[model samples]
Target: MLTEAQAWQALDAVEDPEIPVVSVTELGIVREVVAEGDALRVVVTPTYSGCPATELIAESIVDALKAAGAGAVTVETRLSPAWSTDWIADDARAKLRAYGIVPPQSAAPGGGQVVRFMSRTLPCPRCGSTRTTRLSEFGSTACKALYRCEDCREPFEYFKPI
Candidate 1:
C-alpha cells in the first residue's frame, strides 16, 4: 500500500509541462494527497481554471501515482479558493528566476482580480536590470507577459500574478 508520504515523494518528481525546471508540487499545484485502502486520491489546483495543461497535468499525476505502486489513482480538480501565485514555493520562485522567467513580484491582488497590465517595473531575470518594457500582454502563454530588457536586449516572460 502506498502511503501519503510516498505518494508525495513520487509526485515531487513530476515536473510542470510548461516549466520543466520545477516540480508540480513545487509549483503548488498538488494540493493534497490521500491514500485510502488500495486507492490514492490527489487534489490539484491549477494555476488558473483555463490553463491549457490542466488535463495533461491530471494525467501525469495519475500516471505517477500508479507507477509508484498505487493500485488505483484518482485526480480531483479543486477550483474554489482559486490558485494564487502567492502559493508558489520560495525555491520554485528562485528556480523561475534561474530559468530566465521573471517571477511574480508580490502577492496577487485580492478579490479575485488578475493583474493583466503591469504598472510596476519588472526586473529582467537575465540581466537583473529594472529597465524593462512589456512587449505584449500575452507571452508564450496566456498566463505570462512578454517583456524586453533594455540593458541586455533580451526578451523574457513574466509570470502574471493571479
Candidate 2:
C-alpha cells in the first residue's frame, strides 16, 4: 500500500535507459501517478512520438514500482500535450549540460509557427562559448544535433528542443 508520493520516489529511482544519469522523472516524462485501490497508475509522455526508448522507460517504471512493493503498477502513455524541453526540470538541465550534452533552450511561449528553414545558434556545452558550428542535424539519436565548438574544438551533442 505505497502512497502516491512513495510511488513517485520509486519511479524516480528508475533511470532513463538511454541517459543513465537522468531518471525518467527528471526527464519530465512521468506526468502523473495515482494510487488506485490496490494498483498504481503512472502517466508518461514520451520525449518524442517515435522515440524508441519509450517502451523501455515504461518497462523500467513498472519494474521499479513493483520492486518497491507496489501492487499492479500500470503505465499509460499520453501524447496529447506532447513533451517539451520546457518541462525539463532545472536540476535535470544542469545534469544534462554537465554530462556533455547541451540542454535544450526554452522555446518561446505559444511557439506554434512552422519554420521552412532556420539556423539555431547553440552554445557549446563544453567550453561555454557561443562560437560553435553544427556538424550534423542528427547526433547519436534523432532528438539530438551534433555540433563542434570552435573555441574548444570539441565535438558534442546538443539536445534539440522539441
RMSD of every candidate to native, in Å, equals 1.7, 1.8
CA lDDT, every prediction? 0.88, 0.86
For model 2, state the Cα shift of residue 162 in Å.
1.2
Q: Candidate 2 — worst ten consecutive residues by lDDT sum?
A: 108-117
Could you give candidate 1's per-residue lDDT for residues 9-83 as a string of tens digits? 999999999989989999889999998788998999978767898899999988888888888898998987788
What TM-score does candidate 1 reach? 0.93
Question: Model 2 over residues 61-142: C-alpha lDDT tens digits?
Answer: 9889988999898899899797887887889888989999998876723667775445577888877898888888789887
Residue 87's C-alpha lDDT in candidate 2?
83
TM-score of each: 0.93, 0.91
Clashing pairs in 2: none
Displacement of the residue 74 alpha carbon in candidate 2, Å = 1.0
